[model samples]
Target: MHVPDWLDAARQRELLEACRRWARPPAGLRTVRTPGGGTMTARQVCLGWHWYPYAYARTVADGDGAPVKPFPAWLGELGRRAVTDALGPEAAREAAYDIALINFYDADARMGLHRDADEKSAAPVVSLSLGDTCVFRFGNTETRTRPWTDVELRSGDLFVFGGPSRFAYHGVPRVHAGTAPGDELGLTGRLNVTLRVSGLPGPAPGGGRSGPRA
Candidate 1:
């Protein structure tokens, strides 16, 4: 589902400012290195849980080794509202949406077609786009080839995929640089914040983390 202009200018600026802060040091934005040893062009930062290639970790296992930033309750709330608006209240359950992957894309950056299959939860992915426009390719679950729909996602646009499309393959093939109202939003590239339910085991009773820190 797509919702255009979901966030007004003020809200877009607010999110841009937040992304600027989140791109700071410690467990901040950095290029992702896949387990296959190839580095991804887009930079990324994580909240609630650190995403390292094909798995989740509490710290940047592939980078600075800092503990990831905590997931903001308000961000999760925004995702809930997006899901409710896109998929309806019946589809928006009180799932503990904990993972947020924010990616920065320049004009040359392109993400290969892939599936959001690492997380255990079947919850929908709530994606919010800010800054420049991009070609978002939504593909099937079985393959990453043709038979996909390419959607033009602009600033303040919201895209939520769930239900039968929860594990579908999707990616950003190209970013239209300078398409953003950079003078106002203070962003030249594209910013995508994807909210998901990690579904990893919760914290133990003693304030310790549960599940494998893989």
Candidate 2:
């Protein structure tokens, strides 16, 4: 479901500023290379647990050796509230969300159809959109093809998918360029922050390889 205008102007400004800070250094936003060797157009930063091509680690395994930024408690609270608003109080009480993937999209950026299968938990995923609007394709679990729904996600919208839709395939086909929420917000692109529960037994042992920046 999509909840439009879920966050007021002040809240949007606050989160946008926070995102700018989170997009720096160590675990900051960077283009991601898939296992296929191609790079994603949208830059991403992970909190709580760092996400590489196919695994989750405590540190930026593919970038600097520094630990990923800690997930803010307030963000978790926001996620809870979002879930409660989209689903119900029972879900909010049961969800122990611990991970967040923040993706920034420029005018030409787009995401391919994919599933959030890396997570071990069956908890619902809460997605919050800020800035430019986008055509979000929600597909079935079996494939990335047809029989999907296209939803236009505008700034301050909240979308929660769980239960039967937890493992469904989804992607951003396109982002409306130059459609940000005005200059007052100090943003020029789209910011999508998705909250999930990693449900990992524990953080991976031994630090990741210290590699050059991607």
The 10-residue segment of model 1 with minimum total lDDT is 205-214
lDDT of 1 at 75: 76
Residue 20, model 1: Cα distance from true site in angstroms: 1.1
- Over 82-156, each residue of candidate 2 has an lDDT whose tens digit, in order, gives 999999898878677788899999999999999999988988899989999999999999998888999999998
lDDT of 1 by residue, 141-177 (tens): 8998888999999999999999999989999989999
Please state the error at residue 47 of candidate 2 in Å.
Answer: 0.4
**How do all models score by TM-score?**
0.93, 0.93
The count of backbone overlaps in candidate 2 is 0
